[model samples]
Target: MVKLLFLLVAISFVLLFSLTDFSGESPKHGESMMSVHLPDFRLIPTTGASGPESFVFDISGDGPYTGLSDGRIVKWLANDSRWIDFAVTTSTREGCEGPHEHQRTEHVCGRPLGLAFDKSTGDLYIADAYMGLLKVGPEGGLATRELDEPLRFTNSLDIDPRTGVVYFTDSSSVYQRRNYIGAMMSGDKTGRLMKYDPNTKQVTTLLSNLAFANGVVLSQNGDYILVVETATCRILRYWLNDTSSTTTPESRGNYEFFAERLPGFPDNIKRSPRGGYWVGLNTKHSKLTKFAMSNAWLGRAALGLPVDWMKVHSYWVKYKGNGMAVRLSEGSGVISEVFEGKNGNKWMSISEVEEKDATLWVGSVNTPFAGMYKI
Candidate 1:
């Protein structure tokens, strides 16, 4: 009986040690699997027949803020708070055909992608995929194109207040926004990150041949720039001070992969005034989805089928591939916390503005509820 008891004890010790080792060193190859219970959040109920695509607080103005949706931009006042169309997009509507027919509003044809307010000039810098970069000033506004060449598919935009230099991403050189799915399915790395100097009127390519470069953000100190390579599931860093990095004309600076092996496809990223940057995850990466995406032939064949059939197939794939978010803190390689957004559907781009206290006014491209929360 003593010998039998000794053997059982020994077996238990070995199992315990093995379990501890595995749990300690387990790598998060796909989803973080670490679930987070966020604070109770609700949609700040938007009315008046508008589907706001993006929201930003006007720093220059007081009380009310601005939201860009569909074909119109609306002003939302906090006091006597009501949303009204401040500026309706009534620009040229010629090339707005086919899939982008919705963009051709009776007022505006081009869709606004990214927006930044120029500190020194008080002008709003807009990056429209079809219209390139534009400057819209106050007084119910007029827009003037800053760059002559229209972008292939311009995305996120940010301007450095100190240097007056603007940075933006052209998602794909070969594939436009209408065919965005085609570009992603093909895993085409034709995306480019660019810099435009307002002073010199010179545009330079920072990084090229990126796999769907989506978001661009300057570091807090303006030392390094972070650009997201969406399909590759990584963020690349470009050093502004390192001139001896590379001689290639397409080189922006000495770039290194900042963060990699994200759980899902990264859409947009924004720097928080408090600290850490928030990344918006569109869809979960699943093995089945990866299988479909792995082979070009399979992806093409699937896409060639009827739209409903393709969607039903994708629906099952998405069930496996889902929720993820990462917080990158102060240029450090370490990601602080990972948050899962929604249970079923993915949460696309996240646009945040500062409100009272340190609360973040959050908005999503696809989320049904848009509200504020403390991280």
Candidate 2:
């Protein structure tokens, strides 16, 4: 009886430790700010929507535009204390305009995941899961689809203001937005990073055979691009030399690992206000989660289990802090971190962390409100 009790205690520790961030020594207090300093933040509800997937600010910096789960782009009017609808991804609205999940009406009503803006033109670009790339002018109403080809799982995007070029990612060819869990678990590698040229109205594939390409962003000066590979828990960098977007022998060589062996599964990455980049971790690294993700056969077999795959998958991946956020330097070194254990209920499944004016705008993929944390 005594040995059994001891064994149970050991198991509990393993479960807890796996839910923490990637393996690394904590940075010095001067080099980085630890999350212990982060307290409860102010909440901004989504009104009738949920899942503020990603956030962006326009050229004038007057708005923090975000895409919603129910297929609408909303802008937060701080002074008015309200969220107003600015755009929608799909013109067909038979079952849209209400709260819903992606598994049910994403294909019909459309689901916008990534949002970006062309600072010069004041045009908002959206990466919709079902409808591909979309755009709305400064006025903002019903966003129009702007892609010649279809992108099944348009995850995230970033724009180059200098050239007005749009760079985005398609999570997987086999799985659309509705079944992203299967894509991540089965280790699908058909994901891609591509760019769209507004001048020519053509899309070019930059890199292929990726393990779940999630968040994306350009350098502070638009010199290179950084992409998050979720399944592998690393960031990949592609240097830009010219306007060439197609894949070539030399171009492929330019793609290299910017950061690797991340402790948590990185979801979205945005440029920090001070310097470096802020990467949001959707889930901490757990033993069960790592084992299942590493073994393709095991992951596929688990899908056949009698239980609900989504729920089962969620059980395998646990969050220790309720949420984890990290800021990386220009050289991909860990600078500071935040663990939302104190108020994990306020946010989880973090998808975007936008820093502005000494505050971190925290958005989650499964939460209905955004949390504002002071830096």
TM-score for all models, in order of appearance: 0.74, 0.86
In order, the Cα lDDT scores of the candidates are 0.60, 0.77
Give the range of the ten consecutive residues with the poorest summed lDDT in model 2.
Answer: 339-348
Top-scoring candidate (lDDT): 2
lDDT for 233 in candidate 1 is: 75
For residues 234-268, write the lDDT of model 1, one tens digit per residue.
Answer: 78888887963455554544987777776566766
User: By how many angstroms RMSD does model 2 differ from the true structure?
Assistant: 5.9
Clashing pairs for predicted structure model 1, backbone only: 89-107, 89-108, 90-107, 206-252, 284-322
Clashes of 2: 1
Write candidate 2's Cα lDDT for 1-375 as tens digits: 755655554454356445534333344566544453334567888887788878888878866888887888899887898888898887887777665554478788888889998888899999998889999999998888887696778989999888999999998988887778778767789999999999999899998999999899999888789999998888988888644334654335767677777767889999987888999888666565566556676565544444455554444443332456678888754555554433234244677789898878888877778878775
Q: What 10-residue stretch in candidate 1 is worst by lDDT? A: 17-26
Off by more than 4 A, model 2: 1-31, 36-39, 99-102, 242-252, 311-321, 343-346
TM-score (C-alpha) between model 1 and the true structure? 0.74
